[model samples]
Target: MISNEMAQRINTQINREMYSAYFYLGLSAQAETMNLKGVAAWFLAKHGEELAHALKMYRYLIDQDARVQLSEVAAPASVDGGVLPMFERTLEHERGVTATINEMVDFALSAKDHATNIFLQWFVTEQIEEEATVKDIIGRVRLFGDQGQSLLMIDNELAALAKQIGQGAATAA
Candidate 1:
């Protein structure tokens, strides 16, 4: 059985994951408003991933005989300017999540919770990939600044990535 403190911590992490989904959903709405269909699709895929992350934690908590108390998720801030700012925010958010995960890992280590630590290992690696992916998108968006053709190319690439991720998730499910 997980300790109350650990269970609470995991619950907070699950809420954060839900907030991430909300944030991505907001981004998707903004992208759709801007008529960037591919970008919107990418954000939608990310939103789904975030929801899955939350559910994974929720299920784990239930399996550990811990209460899964979900809190209300706040609305995400809409991006009004452009893609650069959005991607920059995405990178920043991922960095924040990495820090949270690292803190949890540290807590697990100090408490000698080997199982939690092992479970979090996947998240640590996943965060690295998440940060890299956001950074890459930021770079691409910056490079294509105000260039329609380049923007479309980047959008197509993102669309392909979204499709691949969706397919992988479906297969995993």
Candidate 2:
């Protein structure tokens, strides 16, 4: 069973995850306006992933018989500049998420909540993958230059990746 404090913290994380989904949705809309369909699709896929993360936490809280207090999710600011900037923002957001997850892990450990700690290990690993993936994408954008045929090629690759991610999410679901 989770302590009230831990449950509250997890509830906070659920809200943050919900906000991340909104953030990605906003980015996807921005990508669509820029005519980067593949980028938009990628962002949409990420939005789905964020929702899944929230649901996972929700289920965990239920399993632990803790109250899941959900608060309002703030709207994300409009993303602009360009695709690279958008991804930079994504990386920044993801890093923030990683920090929060780390904090939760530390909290769980210090509280001797081994079950919660074990539960959070999944998020710890997920954050590592998320940050690395964003970094790699940023590197690719930098290496390819974000324009013309090169951008199209990159966009195409993103589209393929989105499809793969979508399939994985579907399978997981």
Candidate 3:
């Protein structure tokens, strides 16, 4: 059985994941407004991924017989600059999530909640992948530039990535 404190922490994480979904959805809409269809598609895929993440945690809580508390998600911050700035924001958000997961892992370990610790290992791995992916995107944007033909090339690449992620989500489902 999961402890109340741990369950509460997981519930908070679920809320964060929901916020992440909302954040990505907002980014998708912003990309659409900028006419970056591929970027929009990518963010839309990310939104789906975030929702899946939240649901995964939600199910875990239910399986543990813990109460699930849903909370309101805050709106995503506005991005004033362009594509690079948007990606930078993504990286920043991901790093914050990593920190939260790390804290939870530490809490689980300290509390002798081995099962919860084990459960969180999946999230720890996921955070690593998420940060690395965003870093790679940032590097690519910097290397190729974020405008003209370069931007178009990046968009195509992102469209392919979106499709790949969408397929992975479907497979996981």
CA lDDT of every candidate: 0.88, 0.95, 0.95
- Could you tell which candidate, 1 or 2, scores higher by TM-score? 2
Comparing 1 with 3 on lDDT, the higher-scoring candidate is 3
Q: What does the lDDT come to for candidate 2?
A: 0.95
Name the better of 1 and 2 by lDDT.
2
Off by over 4 Å in 1: none
Tell me the lDDT of model 2 at 27.
Answer: 95
Q: Rank candidates by lDDT, best first.
A: 3, 2, 1
Residue lDDT tens for model 1, 38-114: 88899999999898889888988998899999999888787667877888888989999999999999999989988
lDDT of 3 by residue, 1-173 (tens): 89999999999999999999999999999999999999999999999999999999999999999999998888888787999999999999999999999999999999999989999999999999999999999999999999999999999999999999999999999
For residues 35-84, what per-residue lDDT tens digits would candidate 2 score against the true structure?
A: 99999999999999999999999999999999989999999998777989
CA displacement after TM-score superposition, residue 90 of candidate 2 (Å): 0.4
Error (Å) of candidate 1 at residue 156 is: 0.9
